[model samples]
Target: MKSSVDQIRERFDNDVERFSNLETGQSATIDAPLCLELVAEAAAAATPEARALLDIGCGAGNYTLKLLEQFKQADATLIDLSRPMLDRAVKRVSAATAGRVEAIQADIRGAELDEQRFDVAVAAAVLHHLRSDEQWSTVFAKVFASLKPGGSFWVADLVAHQHPGVQSAMWHRYGCYLADLRDAAYRDAVFSYVEKEDSPVPVMTIVDHLRAAGFVGIEILHKHNCFAALGAVRPITGG
Candidate 1:
């Protein structure tokens, strides 16, 4: 069975220090630091005049902090499932940005975001936890609703492959990367947790969801191994 939400929260609550570093990002994820930079730069380029930011599953707020460097005057809203994670993100983000920081301890699946409120929204290494198609659709739609016209939403996360052979090949590569990063034990542990907790979808699936969510100008920023980063903009011409 998949890990329960409470279990996921408990795990993150104790792992704040691992996620606190902006330099490495989540060490377990492939090209974590690169994706961080990519997402931040892409968001800045896409919404150069952004004045407000929303970070779903903010974790230690690394993504938000990076974006703050670009949107120096933008207020930030951070949401996460673990209070400790949220607290750490708030502390770090507040220190980095002169703009106001708002932290909410809640899952993205059910978080109530105000409509047309933000210029940029980012979700990093977080959406993979979404288990069902409906959950994915709902969260995408909600994130869409929360952004202002011409706003953008960015995502960097592990992604699945539609073909079984391709998925296996990617999974194997990811496993080798993990083993090389540490040891076989570490790789097994990471694999075990993913099997029990994650339900990532393919990059194409995400694109379809974004299209259905009313986003335009979709762009795939990066993809390496099993990870990918992408963004889509809400059209200024539409409601």
Candidate 2:
């Protein structure tokens, strides 16, 4: 029998196909190139030889494609809970990477990954959907388990604030401003999705989670508004 994570992944796969085709404004700009720049920077800093990379939640293959371009020698595995998203990504990266990029439709929370290890693991804009602290802990533990010694994990996500009033107000204003410029469908889908799952956790909590999961050398590499990039490394043997 498939696990709960597997069931969630099946649901997510269906939703992502709808989400990807909905003409949502956020889907267009809030993707790989912009997000992976931060991740690549963090990965490079953590290890000089990032020859193998794994991208968790690799929707539409954007970050995986960008990583291949930036790190020519790197082989990437792009895993997502969404089949349609993985299908799209596989098509996009297959040519340039000569099938060096593999896209898998599996939940990072519990699905079995390939036995081969990676120099870096990246998850961008994915943690918020986990819905619980224990889920987050489980996900981080799995990510930690997948890495090679000295390998790093890079994450970029929305950071929850202690005083959410100001940030909430700003997000409302920003949504309104964007609504005025974009089509109604675009605005509605993007804004509605963001608002529905706006329950973010503190950035420090994420850092702490990584540390508790046996990661070391943690650092925040980038920040823009509520979105931030943080990373940590697996310890070298006996150290």
Candidate 3:
């Protein structure tokens, strides 16, 4: 069985220090620094005047903190399942911006987000924890509803491929990368943890859900191995 929300939360609560770094980001993710840079840049380009930021699964606030460098005046709302993670994120993010920093200790699946309140939203190294197609659809719609007109939502996360051969190749490549990062034991541990804790969908599945959620201008920011960064803009013309 997949790890429960409580199990996931506990793991992250103890791992805040690893995620706190702004330079490297969460090292488990392939091209972690690159995705962080890409997502922040793309969000800035899409919403240069963004004044309100929502960071789902904010971790130690790396993604929000990176974006804050671009949107210095933006208020930040950070959500995470781990209170320790939230506390760390709030502390770091608050130190970076004079604007308001709100930390929400709750699963994004159940977090209540106000509609039309945010100019940009980011979810990095998250979303893969979502277990069902319905949950994915609901969360995507929630993010869509929470954005102001022209607001954009960005995601950087582990992604599964639809083709079996491609999936095997990517998984093998990711395993090799992890092994190279540390050792075979470390790679095995990570692989075992992911198998128990994650349920990622294909990048196209995410795009389809984004479209169904009323997002436009969907763009693939980057893709390498089993990870991807993507974004979509909420239409300025629609409700």
The backbone clash count of each candidate, in order, is 0, 0, 0
Error of 2 at 235 (Å): 1.8
lDDT of each residue in 1-239, candidate 1, tens digit only? 89999999999999999999999999899999999999999999999999999999999999998998899967999999999999999899888888899999898988999999999999999999999889999999999989999999999999999999999999999999999999999999999989999999999999999999999999999999899999999999875
**Candidate 1 residue-wise lDDT at 29:** 97
Q: What is the TM-score of each candidate against the true structure?
A: 0.99, 0.79, 0.99
The candidate with the higher lDDT, 1 or 2, is: 1
Please give the range of 10 consecutive residues that has the lowest summed lDDT in model 3.
102-111
Q: Rank the candidates by lDDT, best first.
A: 1, 3, 2
- Which RMSD values do the candidates have, in order? 0.7, 4.5, 0.7
Q: Candidates' lDDT values, in order? A: 0.94, 0.70, 0.93
lDDT by residue (tens digit), candidate 2, 32-109: 245567677667777778788888887766566656766675778888877877887677667557537777776676
Global Cα lDDT for candidate 1: 0.94
Model 2 TM-score, 2 decimals: 0.79
Writing each residue's lDDT as its tens digit, candidate 3 over 54-98 gives 999998999999999899968999999999999999999999999
TM-score of 1: 0.99
Badly placed stretches (over 4 Å) of model 1 are: none
Better of 1 and 3 by lDDT: 1
